[model samples]
Target: KADAKARSSIMLKAEAVSRYPSPAAPLAYGTAGFRARAELLEGVFYRMGMLAALRSRALGGLAVGLMVTASHNPERDNGVKLIDTDGGMLAVSWEKHASELANAPVEQLNQVIASIVVAEKCDAASVGTVLLGRDTRPHSEKLSAIALEGVGALGAAGRDLGLLSTPQLHHLVRMTNGEKGAGPYVGDTAAWNSEQGYYTMLADAFSALLSSGGDRASCSPLWADAAHGVGAPKLEALLSKTPQLQVAVANTVGTGPLNDGCGAEHVQKARLPPRGYEAPLAGRDRAASLDGDADRIVYHYWTKDGSWRLLDGDKICALFVGFIAEQLDALALEPPISLAAVQTAYANGASGRFVKSLGVPVAMAKTGVKYLHHVALENELSVYFEANGHGTVLFSDRATSALLAAKAEAEGASDEARALAAGRLLLVRQLVNQAIGDALSDLLLVEAILALRGWGAAEWDGLYEDLPSRQSKLPVKDRTAITTTPTEERLTSPLALQSALDSLMAECPHGRCFVRPSGTEDVVRVYAEAATQADADALALRTAQATWELAGGVGEKPTGAAA
Candidate 1:
């Protein structure tokens, strides 16, 4: 009976499948997430349902929740994500499972079913529950229907949380855990983040702050570029949830959601020429844009000359850390929180050192937020950063209490640990002053410090004092230039890359240089950071030129003067 329903659902969705047919799987998992050709709706749906089922079982039979739509991926591309039982991201280890299921034969798939049944210790007659949510893509509607076939086939009750952000789906899973008569079951929520739930947290934090003092009139209106993905509706939901904040959204309808016009990936201010203003690749002040799913953010602030200063991942991390620190000081806290921040390799070293000088502990990880997030989990970190503007702060109540107690018991004068402990008393006070990683969380730290101590972004900028730098990417005609294999291979001759890096580091405004083959495309990513902008540019260009030569690809030289 269930199989019949499943077949009916797929058959009903046949027209959509035919229309989409799944784009040539032109995407691979990038640093932040996976992206694929939008036409491949069937493959995407297959992966989605399998992940949903796997996540469900991982959390003790809790309904697995899925958000179906690629956030910020290119228009020709789409994606699927799994929210875990605790409303956190699914373990990266599970990506392999998704791949396995995606490629399994019908017979092999049935074997997987038998294995899961035995593993879950369930009888053939038992059923589970799974919830699915999707965004506005035309293919998404079809993918959802086909995915539903798989969900129903699994004997899992299916519920719909339509047009939700990744964060909202996460929240739904969390809320369901506490709902009345929701379950006699394991009671765990979904197993991943929701695009909508993040906005909810932001809204919650903002509402809490506003309610603490100001009335409606004193509040400022906020605007966003919806990127024609799921960001608009989710942002709307967030504002609706927090009535105190006046929110106006734009560029939502028919926007491409990638590094297209009017998104964090492109478009700065209304002033920077309507088009061809691509240098900074994001807008200036008063507006912002989110990718398809809204997990990451980029700033749109302007220079004094009315030129745009698109705040990249490094700037955002610096802004948040500085802002949170000031908030801690205002409450007369003596660094009680013992702040520890983690950033990825791609992040600017200036921010890392700046954070450390403030007596906060900092760790450097590889180039992914997942690594940063893991460090936070391992250290119970108060904050973490990625050069790409992906970040979050630790907010566990249990962790806060421990820090407070540590600070409270420190003697008037004691060892470093004791002093560190005493310093921690301010963490709770700071957290209360500023909600944990609130999306409404602005770059207030610089202004706050200026107002309080006569300091500025330049002052923070002095910590590691970035050397002049330049960076560019060159594409290769063949995948052979980089490795096409799933396994890691040398993107270019290591010795050649090292020689270029050594040359750059030996020069004034000394810095490092490296070459990376893009995980999602056949391009070589050349990065260099130095004290003098000229040195940075030269180093980046040289390394990139070397990479291009190695790959047998022609390339253009770096452009524009160092700011």
Candidate 2:
């Protein structure tokens, strides 16, 4: 009953499935996707490729994406995040299918995949294209090629775009599935959606913002720590397109290992200069650090009084909220546009208050960019950020349309204020990476804001002093035993652990604490903040002590634990 092409396709997929057998241990496709050691991911990559191809077909043959990178993970480790048809994380609904396919036995692999095809209502003949990209890792190319083979096995086309940052690949996938045109298209899609187009898009938007604000900035040079990964060359290329700002880049590829004492994670968590900048940093000089794949970024600097200040996602949110609130106020459109900021529980308490002072309600979501992104969609204009410096501002279709309509109506009108506000808002929308949280795009946005206000990192930090906070993770025998409330602001499971931590928090002034299992690692993360640095550090230490006492430590038996 089947044609030669269908049978041949079946054989190809079967053969491909046989080549990479799943590991004995089961793996789940969590928010971070199926991440593990690079060697353990051969089977995962092939199956994910098939999943992405199927996802494309499920969405009427739009291009789905596969990004190969472990982000800030060590160089020896790598993972993949499946970019959905709309250029965001793969649909949460499909995550179950991904996990089922990933952990399926070799003997049942073909049947499992077939069942998925039937369940998703994907026609065998409706094979679609899968766009692939990878970071600069030793084994990334090989893994990406294997994923492409998986795509081919499904009778789907595969396009491997070598060495792209995670967000770049996301942008291109969105462009491929979007409407056709030139620069500045409707909604969120771009006209020229290639690597060059990404740079051109950001550069052009930066120029437009500068023009709208008046002139270029003459601020001090900002140093960029590249994490010695794909972001090094990519950032260089993006900056070459903009000749106005002076940025000194270090820790480039071949200079050091990926995320080895550098990158946004190191800078934000450790609160220290990256590997290359071990020397004393001059006061007033600002710096930005990007993780391996360049999807996350955090800025830091030392004050003149010898104090180091890190402008984390919380700080960035405050600055953007203030500036965007000003722009929205300037436009003052009828019916008034709704604006909000979305953050995870890891966000500083002071940040919530700072934004609230600007009359913008802040919403809290579970950890992970996908969760925050979904919450942000509720507002006309929403800024979402995690404490780790991974997030973006989402402009809804209605919000964008309003701005566009305002711009058109303001044409030849005597309202210069309306015209200028519309111009800045439009450019800001373009400057942001709506597809995902993008580091380079975020850096440019910060720079543009500072230029407009003629302020530096100092002024941004001055918005609100952050409560001292510390994040610690303890290896657990079984991390799943740890759980939290929906907001992750309180621990619900293991009442003893929660009681112990609550007591610890009560001892410190303005103290707050919570614990949750890390999505990507086999450990439970504890976050503690207090009014003073010593109290914050001590509170984090005490929480770990409490957990150890209750769980009897990782290796030892968990004596007092109650599920």
Candidate 3:
């Protein structure tokens, strides 16, 4: 009877799927997932639901996660990213299957599902379970229903988490899967799987880190921009729990369109605070911005003289590297764990140099969190962040075990060493959101670190100077013509494009340039940096022109300085 019901469910669901069909041009799951205009994504979401169910079956019924958000994209745009049972991005092999299933025609959808079952050895009778969540987009509720319908078609259990930040959903997926003897879950698995659990965990960690240090009063309040998305309410809730850490949130919920001239993307692109955000008087008045989905953040502050300075992902990684290194030294563990920083080619040249100067090795990954996460996992402790403020610190099981043992041993050590060891180790583990790059968690980390170091945003920004940089997107008729190295540091396709860029870079001091196809959009991205802003802007435009001329660019050449 159960088997028959499952088959019936699939048949009925397949019939409902006819309402949404693949576009004439297939949608490719990019660095994140299927992101485009919301109107074109109903079919994709339905198909994603089906794929999520199959994936759950493939993983022996472990809970999979589906997040409906576009991160920093505009309001009209939406996307779906599948999370594996372990809470990471979907596996590369499965990513291909998802693309295939998403683009499958309406009539062939059932056949495609069958092929996936065979390919993945998914048990049709197994109960598929999926955790679904969405952001604040207007169309999210409707799209989510389509997704649930897809899950129902496969006789899969679906848990609608209502609205949640992207990282919140990722954390819930990890916690749910961790309940299955996956080596002692982080915090309380039950509590950590709920919205309140997430807020409480972060608040508790922040409180602990604050109280561990001498005076909590010394900690400064922050000005935060939530991109008018979900982070505003979430941040408010978190602050309510940890009253010791104060934040005056701007662009709060319902106040503005999502990511409309505010957020990490705005800060990174414009090198200024979001619109309508007023920086508090200079010293110690730090500010941060969370993107639409609250998975990425960029921090900034005004100097005593009122000049604004920004600290992006590269600087974040550098500061964390220094702080972690100091803790490791103070703890004086018997066998030191290896530490490395992971970055993409887009990382500023000065930031990379600063990390190397600290004697920490650096590894380059492709331009995405999953790629960086993979590289970070290779070391005992790895710190990674993209230039656009998407990243988190990763501690391996070995490192976690080592820290725990060290903390245990410190119980008998000198009082000062013991206090330092206990506070730093526990806070390090608690402060970072290991499931993904969480803006709220990262903000707490920055606050904790700033307090510990007795420094303000100005002091942190002083760690390294960012070389002036510019990024441009050129519309290319065929972005496929552009191929890049594994790290995306060098372009290998279109023959002499690299050579042309090399000549252009040579014209400016400390100049660098690279071009690659945008994963989420239809255009190609060009990045350039130099000793000065003027040189960087000029190099970027020239490099973009070269890319357009060589790589089937369709529109008029990009003009003016980089925005």
Candidate 4:
């Protein structure tokens, strides 16, 4: 009888599915997932809803996630991405299957879904759940509603978690599917699985970690720019959970569209403060920006010399990995757990060198959190951060076991130092959202680390000098024409373009440059770094010029003083 209900559900959904027609152009799941103008995404969302439910059924009724957000994209745009049972982005191998399902013709949709079920060995008749969350976009609510219908079509439950950040949804998915933590951050704990529980967990972890590190009183006030999206409300709710951090949030609401002139991408790429931050940040006045869905973050402030400075993912990783390594060294456990740092090709040359100096191996991956997270998981404990501020620390079962055992022995021997060291790492794991990179969670983390070190924003920047670097997007007739090697640090196709780009990069002292298609948008991204700002800008411009001329660029050439 249950199987009959499930079979009929798919047929019932076919009628509703016909309402949303696929766009004239096909959609491909990119580094994140399927994204496009809001008008073109309804069909994708409904299909993803079914896919999410099927994924859950395949994994034995474990809940999956569907987040209706376009991280860092403009309000005119929206997106939907599936979260796997592990709370990470949908598995890479299955991305192609999702693409196939999304692009299937409406008439043949059920057949395609059946094909995926058979290939993936999914029990389509099994009941499952999909947790749905949406951003602040006007269309997000309606899109999520359509997705819910698709979930019902599969005879699966859809728990709608309205208006949540990207990472929040990922957290709930992992927790609902039974991810466990050592102490209070438990998956089976029903409270920790709710949106409010999310805030409470982050707040409690921050409070404990800060109090443990001594003098939380001296902590400096930090303000987070909310990017006029769901992060503002989430940050406010976080404040309700704990009052320890002397911080304030701004850009809580905006009359204009979301991320119009604010966000981590704007701050890091455009080199300007987000809107509503008219007052210049100086001295120890630390500030951070969150993208649309609040997954990425970048810290910034104005230097005394009136120069603006930004601390991005590379800096975040350098600070975090160095601190974690120091804690491990202090513990001096006989079964010392291994740790490393993983970065994409976009990381600064100096940042990698600094992490290597701290005695942690730095591994390179392609430009995506999924790639970096998989590579970092190889070690017992690994830190992965993209240059754009999308990252988090991953703790494997091996690391957790070692730390717990070491702490037990230390306690037995009354070794206060080792016990505290081991405890600190555990507390950190509790504080961070291990599911994915979270801007809100990361804000608490950086602040707590600074308090422990007695270091201010300027002092953190003083740890390493960034070689001047520039990142820009060159418009092209077809971004797909460009391809790269595995690392994405070097281009492989268009031999003529690659030849010209290499020559241009070699001309600058300490120059490094790469060009590749942006997985999220319709442009070719170019990056260059050099010993000085001028050289970096010039090299970037030259390489973009090579791509423009060789790879069929659009519009007028990118004119700049460097050019």
Q: Rate the local accuracy (lDDT) of all candidates.
A: 0.52, 0.84, 0.84, 0.84
The local distance difference test score of model 1 is: 0.52
Alpha-carbon TM-score of each model against the true structure: 0.73, 0.94, 0.95, 0.94
Tens digits of per-residue lDDT for model 4 on 1-563? 54444445555554436887666688889677888899998888888998998888777778889999887888988899999887888888889888987888898887877666666666656687899999999999999999998888778899998989999998888777764322233434576878888888888878887777775435787878888888888888887877777667777656557887888988888878888664665333778899889999999887767677899999999989988999899898776889999998899999999999999999999998888988887888999999889988888887887888889989999998888888889878877888899998988888888888888889999879999998888889888888899889877888899889789877899899989998877899889899999999998888888888999989888776233
Which pairs of residues clash in candidate 4, taking residues 3 or more apart in a chain or in different chains? none
lDDT of 1 by residue, 1-563 (tens): 54444334333322222322233533334343455666655755764575576456445566667767776566666667666555556567666555555544444565554444344343233344577787677777777776776666555666876776565565566545433313222122242124444444444544443333324323334356666667666667656666654556766746443435655444321212212233322322244555556555554534445554445556656655665565455434444445577776566667777777777777766555556666676553357755555566654444455545555655433434544433433322232211112232332222222233333333434335444445456776764445321212123344554555566567745576766666556666666777676667767776666665655555554343211
Give the lowest summed-lDDT range of ten residues in model 3.
2-11
Candidate 2 wrongly placed segments (more than 4 Å): 1-13, 179-191, 216-219, 280-284, 555-563
State in Å the error of residue 184, model 4. 14
**Where does the lowest 10-residue lDDT sum fall in candidate 1?**
431-440
Can you tell me which runs of candidate 3 are displaced by over 4 Å?
1-16, 179-182, 278-284
For model 2, residues 401-453, the per-residue Cα lDDT tens digits are: 89988988787686889888988988998898987899999999999899888
